[model samples]
Target: MLKHDYKVRTGNNQYEGFLVDLIKEVANMLNFQYDIYLVHDGKFGSKKADGNWNGMIGELISGNATLALGLLSITSQREEAVDFTKPFMIRYITVLMKVTKSTTSYFEFLNPLHPFVWFCTIGALLFVIIVLYVLERIGNINRTDYPSISFKECFWFVFGSLLHGSTDASPSTLSGRILTASWWFFALILILSYTANLTAFLSVKTINTPIKTVTDLASQTRIKYGTVKSSGTSGFLKNTDIEHFAKMWAQMSEIEPSSMVDTSEVGFKKVKEGNYAFIWDTTVNKYKTIEDCDLMEIGPPFDPQGLGISVPTGATYTEEFSMAILKLNDTGRISEMERKWWVHRNCPDYSNPSTDKTSGLQIENVAGVFFILVGGVAIAAVLCLGDYIAKRILKSVKKEKVHAISPEGDDI
Candidate 1:
């Protein structure tokens, strides 16, 4: 591929790969001598704002190379500049990111219910308490067995019922008991729902990632993502009018120093360091991630395209080269070459299938609740001290008033 640096040295120090072999075969059939070399800047050309090309496409347009090969994506923009042979390989752009470890945070308990849901649950509890107090007061107006209940008693009654705890207060009137029963039924359902969701959320170790798709990458600011500069992937991103891709291009272009990298190596290096993602050809990403265990492909590919050899706008070799590539494909030589270079390499099988496993709850999962408990105790201690100090001051004032009122300092 254009991104892969697949090479083998000949006795004369000549390099070889699928493209190299294809070229050699084509030359032999045509009986023409040819020279092979890398593009001047080692890039797949992209059209600059100045209306000129860079990379291998540039070399072809400028008549420096009779044929340009190696993962040269056949795009309409490039076709306008140069003629392309029939596509020899198909590929798509995909995201290559580092595999992040699943994490359980101290606030994992809160993950079950959204903040809005939690707030609404609290509001419902308060509403039930208010309704119960009003109903009980109205029903017990003339009943002496059930004394008037204060706001504090009502709060404790509702709170205890919700927690499946018993309270001393019992409604004597039929209407009061009915309201209490209705509340208990509601509380049971609420409790069951919360428990089920919380259990699921806590049982699974969530993979914390803001990016799962191209839209996710575009919408989030935390991860700085880009593709190789002056490559087909970059060009596709910059030129696409699709909302997410357009937004991503704008952000990449606006940022100083540019998010785009010169090579896939640098792009992937940024990913391993965290808070970055590399977008490039899926084939190259597949090969790289298989080689490096730390790397991973995030999602499916985008902007499906094919790679072809490039020739000058009016080049005479286009038809012959196209035919040669078709012959190689028909004979299955290309498939054999790809298998030899990509699949049979000395990397471990990172593509091995995995099964999901559940892990036991860790201390971190419930640490937030423990911290809240400690904080409540500390706050209660401060309030208790303040209450004691106020009592002592009030006692002292009363003693002074008693002494002033008595003929002499007598016991009051």
Candidate 2:
């Protein structure tokens, strides 16, 4: 709309916006009182195929209104019908889109870790399983009467360690024992990391980039786009020779249930319902989005044109009104009025917001698990060293006793 509800019927026909305020200033400057009325058709203007103009332009040409205001766009076609004051505001056409909540997938179990992460985990498991199997076979060769564990047995043993925290039987060789210990520590950390992230990791995902421009909309079929009917936005799209925009216009014309809407509010409603994009004036789109965190405008606005006051051609006050607008711009009164009308932001920017709480798990959340694992591994390594030392000392004592004995009967 020219304002969200650009012209509101507040208090039996009172209207507001910076536009309303601006006109008041103009009225005061020119020392002329004015009464504002809505164009009965409620359109800015569009030229019909028969060359008849409608909306505010008709009001101006037919002398039904002395001065037409509020979102009356200055166009070449409209210029021929009514004289336009200097453009007080610039309206850019842009896309308004609603972000849909992501649906949980059926294969959400794999969502906890990315695919690359899962692949690496499997790779690590296979590597450890193969190493354990090969080491056991080599040990069997060294001790000729022993039998090595099978590949299947090695896999189940390693997998059991990952799931249940440990295997009942471990390899006999020292190298294989060390590998098993390392795998156990890894399993502990991985389990902790996965559990810590399980709930948070499965939330939302962005499947595609947001449609920020007309070309982005044109390139995709998933989201339907449209603008208000018979407004400058539609006229621009319909009249332009640009390929992508032309495609968009063609779709709007031919699409079922009709993409064109009666009002900006309807366009915005479709966007909210889902898979719809509303292309309209940036200012109105921005106004809607500013107060509702769920709604948003995405752009570098296109097809920027001026919103100007309209009067019949050869009107005496046209120059006076343009100069008044220039005065307001120079004095920054227009800006002041704009801020006053849009009001303060009622909703925070969802895309980039300031918050007191962190939303999801980070490495910091699982770092303590890794620390516990490292400590456990270090203690195990030290205990293994102590055990090896104790074995060697016992072996040395037995050898000395055997060497000192005379005829194996008396102690030395």
RMSD of each: 9.0, 11.5
Which digits, one per residue and each the tens of the lDDT, describe model 2 over residues 1-412? 1344535554313665667778789988989887776778777777778987788787777788888876666888888888999988888887887854434443454566888989999999999999999998887786755567788888989999998744555687777889989999999998888876675554323333356445888877778888889988888888999998888898887763388898777888898897888988877888878767677677767887898988899999899999999999999998888787566666534333222223454454445557777899999999999999999999999999889998958776
Candidate 2 stretches with Cα past 4 Å from truth are 1-13, 102-110, 114-160, 163-168, 173-209, 255-257, 343-412
What shift in Å separates residue 286 of candidate 2 from its native position after superposition? 0.9
Reference-based lDDT, each prediction? 0.79, 0.77
Worst window of 10 by summed lDDT in candidate 2: 349-358
After aligning candidate 1 to the native by TM-score, how far in Å is the CA of 322 from where it should be?
A: 0.6
Error of 2 at 338 (Å): 1.8
lDDT of 1 at 411: 48
Candidate 1, 294-358: lDDT as tens digits: 77776657898988888999878789889988998999988987886677444332232243345
